[model samples]
Target: MSGMVTSAHAPRRDETERADGSPVTIGALVPLSRPGWAEAGRHLLAGLELAVGEVNDAGGIGGRPLELVVRDTAADPQRAAAAVDELAGLGVAALAGEYHSVVARAAAARADALGLPFLCSSAVIDALTERPTHRVARIAPAQSHGWRTYADFLLGAGHRRIAVAAQPSVYWASGTRILRDHLAARGASIAELDMTEQPATAVCDALAEQGATALLLLVGHPEPAVSIVRSVRQDPRLADVVIGAPAGQPEFAEWAGALGASGAGIPFLRYLPERLGPLGARVGTALRERLGQPPSFVAFEGYDTVAVLAAVLRDHGTDRARVAASWPHVAVEGTRGKIRFSRTPGTGVWQWAWPPVQVVDRDPAEPARFRILHTG
Candidate 1:
């Protein structure tokens, strides 16, 4: 259980409660500890906690206080699956929150087996399940959808020859395929530089030789990814090459902290509209307070996850089947935009169809500021 875990019932002074007095519990799976992207997890947890707090304050599910039964996934698939099984056993109405796609897939599979409702918050893998299951739905944009948009951004920027510093993972592989297929259709080609085999300097050597105009960081953060960015930025031979992270690595403060000016001008994917609507503006302000830093897109995804689930739980009640059934019926105003789930083709689960996608980079002039380069 997370430190943020609320008791099953802790109604406010003015709030009402059910006769049973049991809270409506949500299972929250976040990568909070080592080996996981803990910074992203903190932002994600902040959003989830903030939304859960607001839901409780605004009168929880039918007077019963809403609660989160939090679990730390630690970025391990097996750990995530185990957590899902445990959460299902704990009688949570649904599961939510995870930033890593592979871990989310593992949790999704377990949730499907247990017939537990799961509203995945931030993982963007296209195939979240081995097959379609009503029990699992997603709030994030599908990898195919977001990555194709990223490919178009690269092409429109006139990068004919692109190289990716890729690690071994299904998520990275899927992104590579999406970019390759989309870019190839427009007469551009991609080269893969395996991070497992090459050092950062070696990648620069290959980029220099290939004369690639872009190098996408399709690897993990701060280690190989940060090192690669440093090496590429230092190598004058590849000075003109654009560094990109279609996976949205640089959206958090840690990326800028690690690479500073070198991290600037490196474009990454972000899911946000050109401007926030009224609800979004309010939530963003609240989230900034909750997080003590500007919230990332993942934080919005967390808030939206709760917003959608709370609507379902309030309208349809806490029956597991009803919550699962409520995915198609959801139409809640979220922090980003109107969020609803439907069966998107090839997604194998309920999807939001699309969240706004943008190609953004930390401004070269001010690394703390982000500049949107393209939108889709």
Candidate 2:
């Protein structure tokens, strides 16, 4: 239950050491065993590894090589909190890497309690960064920001009557509420269906009966979204309905493949594209070579997470307090776009106010090839 791995002896640091004969260790907390998100964690680890290799190859931070101490959370909140304490016990200068929003919340609290600088890579819940502590910051935009992007896309497409299918989790519910409120302000009507209580076919039938022209999936996970898409496609009356999900983009291929030809033309919002900028292209190529596939936005976020940490450690050394204090003034151009953290009224403290995002759909013949529909 502790999820601790005990070695016979202390791990060797020679291979990871720099010219200064020391290693600046960073702790990476990711879910490697969650049923639906294990592959996502692996992809994110690939990105972190890629950035670590590049940083060490370039002489590291102030001649001290950066090392990553990875811990798997199993996508569980309690385990994630324990991982934070475990990493701090191992003497890591900072912490990063988390996929699950609920787990990220636990990790953030633990990191703050321990006075460690925690840079959240991919968790999008608004409350994670809203804590009273200055030890936490996030790279991903909050769910409200992402939902607004989707709302704009749906409204701009002339889809006034939209239907939403959402899971019962707090994360999904909050995101769905944002989407609903935003769309409602623009004179759009929306019907709701609870994914946990109803079957996908029944939900699709209800939406079709409501004269819905578009379906927005607020389910936080991919499997349910995929199932709903497949079920909706079975009815000829809903064939023209535009299906979109902001959270399903990371695991697009897995669920989209289940839908096969039916998944094409379905749009989802992604934070980073394959060829966003120079850094994006460079990381994308490295990921394609390492993972044997294109990099997801989560991967890009992972890479940039390390990049930002390295920059801070280089200038501020490994002092946790200094690193956390320096985040407010830290601003740099990253793979996706400009990377900066700011405190906004509704969003949590030290959250990335805006990150570049795009709506893309899979090419029917080639699922790997995604065509961009809109950008914000």
Candidate 3:
């Protein structure tokens, strides 16, 4: 039986076979299908469910089984907001998991308005809530913290002429601005290429005209981004130009499977320590097996999400207000490091402050393997 449950109105026993008939539900928001990055959602869910199974095995939250009331956000802000409403109606103690920043923002806003305590698993937008709220705590690093690190990596790598192939979205726009400000302040230039305004081939032409040494992908996956990469890779004019994705789009296996050698050597941001601790190592092994491949950092984020929530639920009952209030009190040892929350300036929600950040890529010589190029 799956550790996570989908039924909105009933509870089913998972592998735990807990004596208590009642189940504690965490409403999960993930992008499970097209338009959404399904690969990321799968990794996130694997970690959440893996931790859930372990929580159950350890006798659960005071003997009641823990389950995830799953909902697919499908990368839509409106859809994610609706899911937040539906999950609240389902009586979940708290909400968890979401990959896309924009989608998570919508869900976070709605969850806030409804007075639901949400533990965001992933999503790095700085302004998650319009006003400071104790109701939401995040497991992911804020966008500024991670993106600035990525900019430093580019600067250290001798990349001065940077260009971004961008789509129209709040998340992408924020990233472009962050890169532009950080790089420009350090004597570098930043240019924007609108993928929506031009075809992939045309984008290549624009990039070549800009004479950029690095191109940041501030766009979505497998569509214009993939097409742009292929075009740039095949273009002789842009052969020396480096490609980067600060959003970590290339961290998934599907990226390698789809692009093969062409996908290699494009650095991207990821949240993981340079080395995993004992707990992280153990969880990594389990997640690797569960995923049938090496687990991405996102998987660890998912696990930490549940671990924190499980701790909160175990110590403080299932009351919604209590769970939300417990964020500041949390000091659980997570797969990455010790997890805690505080009000980060600018992000209105309670944030983890920072997570280990790495700029990594698939080796051109070994497409299946990853190499860390920079750390933040």
What local lDDT score does residue 293 receive in model 1, on the 0 to 100 scale?
A: 82
Candidate 1, residue 42: the lDDT equals: 93
Work out the TM-score per prediction: 0.96, 0.91, 0.96
Model 3 lDDT per residue over 1-376, tens place? 4465665564322322234557888899989999999999999999999999999988888878888889999999999998888888777888999999989888888998988899998899889887888999899999999999999999999989888889999999998888889889999999888878688898778877888899988888888888888999999999899989888888998888888899999999999999999999999999999999999999999999999999998888888888888989999999999998998998999899778999999999998888999999
Please report, as a residue range, the 10-residue window in candidate 1 with the lowest summed lDDT.
8-17
How many residue pairs of model 1 clash at the backbone? 0
TM-score of decoy 1: 0.96
lDDT of each residue in 72-143, candidate 2, tens digit only: 888888988988887787677889999888889889988998898999988887788445667888898887
- In candidate 1, list every pair of residues with a backbone clash: none
Please give the ranking of all candidate structures by lDDT, highest first, separated by commas.
3, 1, 2
Candidate achieving higher TM-score, 2 or 3:
3
Candidate 1 residue-wise lDDT, 1-376, digit = tens:
2224753443332232244656778899999998999999999988898888888888887877778888999899999999887777767888999999999999999999988899999999999999999989998999999999888899889999999999999999999998999999999999999989778899999999999999999998878999999998888897799999999989999998898898999899999999999988888998898788899999999999998999998898877888898888889888777888889988899999889999999999999899999999
In model 3, the Cα lDDT at residue 331 comes to 96
